[model samples]
Target: MPPRIPVSEAQIDRVVAQFYQRVRAHPALGPVFAGHVADWPVHEEKIGRFWRNALLVQRCYDGNPMQVHRAAGDVKAQHFPVWLSIFDAVLAEELPQHLAQAWSALAHRIGRGLSFGLPQTDDADPVPYLG
Candidate 1:
């Protein structure tokens, strides 16, 4: 196997772009996101900045993601795993193993936090992965 490449801004951009494309096409996620996000290109760039800040310590993102997610009226804790799974697939495909693992770990942490913060619905149970 070849040596693993370090994660970079370019890779982060690629991962975010490709990941959202998959998300937009995903059966469960597509409708949810499409309903909320009016502009794909702008949303994608903001998310890219988010990941770049998270993964590379670039400090480019300033928006409150938790607030944004909370305001997404249809989003629920149940949706997190689907989001994570898609993110995981994207990282696996776009990144070296080491970088993927690192990114995955961070994503899991963020996902769990977001899941925990989501307002509980009477019908929905918190997922074990968030615990």
Candidate 2:
């Protein structure tokens, strides 16, 4: 049998809600998101499902995150660090030590992959492989 996932749907909902709440308040991330996101509730629900699919291994999320982020135009590679930082903070505040750490690692990995696929400007390096 597959190993049981310890996280719950309610926990995923809470984390998504809280994380976006903080992201909306963030200086760098807030503006970028505001440009693309017209309806906060819908966006949050979609993201919540994404996380549920990611962590719980559920096939609830349907959209392609890479395509969405790439289409945003303003989602720079540098944004991943700030995004991951905010996400890590949210995870730390919302979950127990083990869960937070595990989620943070996963988030970072996903962020790295997304950032790597983005087009870089002249000032930015061609390489997106982040440590």
Candidate 3:
């Protein structure tokens, strides 16, 4: 395997764009995202900035992701693995092994936080991280 390259904004943009493309096409995830996202281009740019901030510590993202996810209401713990799977696949395709693993770890952490922290309407336990 090649040595891991440092992550860049361009790489972040690529990953976000490709990941969303897959998500928007996925059977389970596509509808969930489409229902919540009214504008794809604008949402994509915001997501790119979010990942850039996360991977590069750029402080470009300021939204409360937890609140946003919670507000989605339809988002359930079951959706997290689907989201992570898509994200992991994109990172692996777009980045070096080390960078993909690093980003995957962060994604898992964030996924877990969102899964467990989001308000639940029912008594079902929060979904555990599958990645």
Candidate topping TM-score: 2
lDDT of 2 at 71: 88
All candidates' lDDT scores? 0.85, 0.87, 0.84
Candidate 2 structure quality by residue, lDDT tens digits, 34-129? 999999999999998898888887888999999999988889888999999888888889899899999888899899999998865535566777
Q: What is the model-wide C-alpha lDDT for candidate 2?
A: 0.87
Residue range 18-87, candidate 1, lDDT tens digits: 9999999999899999999899999999998887777667778999989988998778888999999999
Selected candidate, larger TM-score, 2 vs 3: 2
Ranking the candidates on TM-score from highest down gives 2, 1, 3
Residue 29 of model 1: what lDDT?
92
Worst 10 residues of 3 by lDDT: 1-10
Q: Please identify model 1 stretches exceeding 4 Å from their true place.
A: 1-6, 120-131
Displacement of residue 74 (Cα, Å) in model 1 is 0.8
What's the distance in Å from true for residue 11, model 2? 0.8
Candidate 3 C-alpha error for residue 94, in Å: 0.9
